[model samples]
Target: MNDDGHPTAWERGVLERLLRDTLIEQRRARRWRIFSRLLTVILVLAVLGLLSTDVTVPQVTSRHTALVQLNGIIAPGTDADADLVIESLRAAYDNTHVAGVVLRIDSPGGSPVQAGRINDEIQRLRKLHPNVPLHAVIDDICASGGYYVAVAAERIYADKASVVGSIGVLMNGFGFVEALDKLGVERRLLTAGAHKGFLDPFSPQHPEDVAHARALLASIHGQFIEVVKQGRGERLKDDPRLFSGLVWTGAQGIELGLVDALGDADSVAREVFKADKLVDYTVQPAYFEKLIRSAGGEAASALVKSLSTTLRWR
Candidate 1:
């Protein structure tokens, strides 16, 4: 009627319907809001309950214990730190209730000097505490220097599937002089001594230098073999290639006398120590320190790889 024609009943009906629909939506939204609030309250209560719950770390009875965790690249503060490992061993050796020591080793080998230091320290501790039983439980890959360290233990235990033996030294690198020649890149290396840059990749490799380096590595390898013999004694088999830079599994290693038994840390502890409680002596790195260390390790490893590769190329 206002537009110019007639009264519109249909329009009035449509407006009423729209108003009804809007009201229904508002009610649904209010209900959802209430449900959401209730859910949040319940979640908060659950969290508080969990927080208030009493939880206790495992404990040992009438026993003093220590656990030396061998983790990372056998470097300082990286689980396999020699200084930290020896300090823990000393503490456990001195503990009146300990009566035994366990070295929980999980390493892929590392610095010879570090491993040697640990081996020597263990020997010293053994002399100081002859009554204390020292055991090595290989968790995963215990090879080369790791096996060297294990030889110092009174006995070694490992799982059947564990990778155990790499009873030799290895120095790996690459040579890329041909590539450089193709690219027409000149290498400039200066040294006062004639043999100072003997293995320099940029410089032509001399047969004498190659012989010298091989001899040096061979000497180191001989020392490693001697130490292994001193540790395992007659247990080692009559294989010339036993120390020939080969790896073996724990099962095979046991047959080859590389390890004492086929079992894990828990099995060894329970069976040998007659107790279930184990203490870890490895220092726990702070969160920030661990992060920084991880970054630093990556960079150092990269540098070493680069240098070794560059040398081999030349």
Candidate 2:
């Protein structure tokens, strides 16, 4: 016992040994935790590396070029976008091992601007690669924008039951003045110009606004018709309704001269391109991109739900 009534030197030795042993254990535990974290990081890095690098390079033969898929809606930043598709097409065209390309299209159509851009790209690529033939294989449906894209190809092929051809423009919306009145809701809109709110659904529609919109649509529709005519050449049948925003079956499409032949992807690949091997260059979103997108969607949904609940309660 010391002067303060504490442990003696011998007693302090045992106490220090116990404390030292506990400290050592704690240090070992921390080191193990750090090692485990480092191992996890290494494993994740390995996986990411493996996924980022393309393991299999597409084998191109002299028989034909790479086959590409153009499925889903054709829009900017989408799988069927013109810029992305064109990049792949350029790759196929530039590939010395490939002889030609077959574009497999399956879509209900989207964005006239996007389709037009794609059409121009395809035509330009074809001009550049005059010898390498590019053919279109229409799957389920290739209407409107889809048909527009197919027109740029050397020939359009589809099954007898496939839906095709809606070479027209459409703008859809609704007027809700009556509904707002029934709900006793007031719509307050302020605009800088007289025609700024011309198409406001809450207010009564102006005849001039309707006329203006119609004119705009008509102009777009005319452009679409001209493109189709240029693509089909003199093969287009005497059907005025072809550009009336009316879709048709594959057989009907052929009759209207919208499609050149009737066949599926495999059939076109085998008969037209003469190559059975298919290579898809459609760029998919990266894992991190998908994660970020999913997280963003979740956050947006949660915010919307919170807002909806608050509005309902109020």
Candidate 2 global lDDT: 0.76
All models, RMSD in angstroms = 11.4, 6.8
Q: Give the per-residue Cα lDDT of candidate 1 at 102.
A: 80
lDDT of 2 by residue, 1-314 (tens): 89999999999999999999999999999999999999999999976864442323455555554777787767654567666676767767767766567888898787788888888988998898788888888889988788888988888888999999877777655578899999999999999998998777678889998898879788888888888888889888998888888888889888989988888767776766677656664445345534654668557755754433111000
lDDT tens per residue, model 1, 205-296: 78998898888778788888898899889989998768876878889888998888887667766778775567665544444445656778
Model 2 residue runs over 4 Å out of place are 1-62, 287-314
- lDDT agreement with native, every candidate: 0.75, 0.76
Error of 2 at 314 (Å): 41
Candidate 1 CA-lDDT value: 0.75
TM-score for each candidate, following the candidate numbering: 0.75, 0.75
Give every collision pair in model 1: 67-279, 67-281, 158-263, 174-312, 174-313, 175-312, 175-313, 176-313, 177-313, 201-314
